[model samples]
Target: MEAELRDPIAAIGLDVEAVDLSVAGKRRMLRVAVDQDGGVTLDDVADATREVSRVLDESDVMGEQPYTLEVTSRGVDRPLTMPRHWRRNADRLVKITLVEGGEFSGRILTSTETTATLDVEGAEREVAHADVAKALVQIEFNRKRSLPEAEETEEDDA
Candidate 1:
């Protein structure tokens, strides 16, 4: 079902991050998490929800059983499991658990396919993706926002 939904979702410029079907007594819930490089807006969710509903309606995948459909952005609470996830989260604070049995918090400096460089305690640490068991973006209530050099504007010379 997920494989079938990917193309339609991608056509609308959103990645299908997750799809889940859960049952609560007689009712079933279909939850689809969508995301993009920058992030997902409410508009994106609405578009995705409409597209998903259209696809489901056109196909026989859902059958006659009524189910609730929810299309939402992949929340920050989800573990960073892909290279794109790491890249999208660069400069964000993250808590990572290693497969070997240790955990640490750091700001992501950069990421490649095989590894991610993190600024841990003012030092840059490169960690292999294979060594990480889980990684989640940390929520900061008072995060500092700074413009990069190229993005900084200077007063016009009148």
Candidate 2:
């Protein structure tokens, strides 16, 4: 069931966050969560669900039984605790805790196979990707702040 959903999502250039299969009463339910670069839209979710359902119908991989299929996006409150999750959310602010018990708050600059670069206080620091004990998206204060008139004038001068 997982491979059935993953293959179509990958072919469509979407990321499959999770695939869950559960049996309810006599019916099997397949839930797939998908995401992409900015985010997943309602249309995108519907399209993916339709495509996956078509594939499943054609393949009859679920056997000769009735099942329900649902596809959706990951919720906003989802945690950025996994390396691939962090990598996908690059350039976003994050609070990272190291395995050695230290914590750093910074923007995720980049990530490689073994390391992640963080822009901390104007200085770029590289930490082992595995060393990130926990990482969560940081709330942005600027989103709530209005720019002062003076700041706007300075921008006009530039």
Candidate 3:
């Protein structure tokens, strides 16, 4: 389904991030996660839904099975499993758990197909893809840029 829907989804400027098929009672649920460079919007999801439904309806792929199709954006809590995922998350803070039962958090500095360089408290560490069991980006909100403003405010108050 992914291969068949790739071209159609790409036509709408969306990329198929993942396809999940599960059994919901007697019916099947087909969840398709779509994403793009910046992000996916409601319009994008709507377009992808229509395109996927049309393609599936016109094809014999579903084989008369009635399934609920859900199109959604990539969730922030989604695990980072691929190099492209790491690349897209560059400069973002992430918590990684190793297959060997070790865990660490750092900001992603650079990434390649096999390794990622992270800034771990002013120190750099390189991690290999094979060593990571799970990785999730940490959400940062209203983070200020540097301490210059705070320092200047203190000087004025004095």
How do the predictions measure up, each by TM-score? 0.90, 0.69, 0.79
lDDT per residue as tens, model 2, 64-91: 8888888988764566655667677788
Candidate 3 Cα misplacement greater than 4 A, ranges:
145-158
Query: What number of clashing residue pairs does each candidate have, in the order they appear?
Result: 0, 0, 0
Local accuracy of candidate 3 as per-residue lDDT tens digits, 65-130: 788999999888899898878888888999999999989999999999999999999999999988
lDDT of 2 at 70: 83
Clashing pairs in 2: none
lDDT for model 1: 0.95
Give the distance in Å from residue 117's predicted Cα in candidate 2 to where it truly belongs.
Answer: 1.5
Per-residue lDDT tens digits for candidate 1, residues 52-139, read: 9999999999999999999999999999999989998999999999999999999999999999999999999999999999999999
Instruction: Go through the candidates in order and give the C-alpha RMSD of each one to the true structure.
Output: 2.6, 4.5, 4.5
Best-performing candidate as measured by TM-score: 1
Query: How many residue pairs clash in model 1?
Result: 0
TM-score of the candidate numbered 2? 0.69
Of candidate 1, the 10-residue stretch with the lowest lDDT total is 149-158
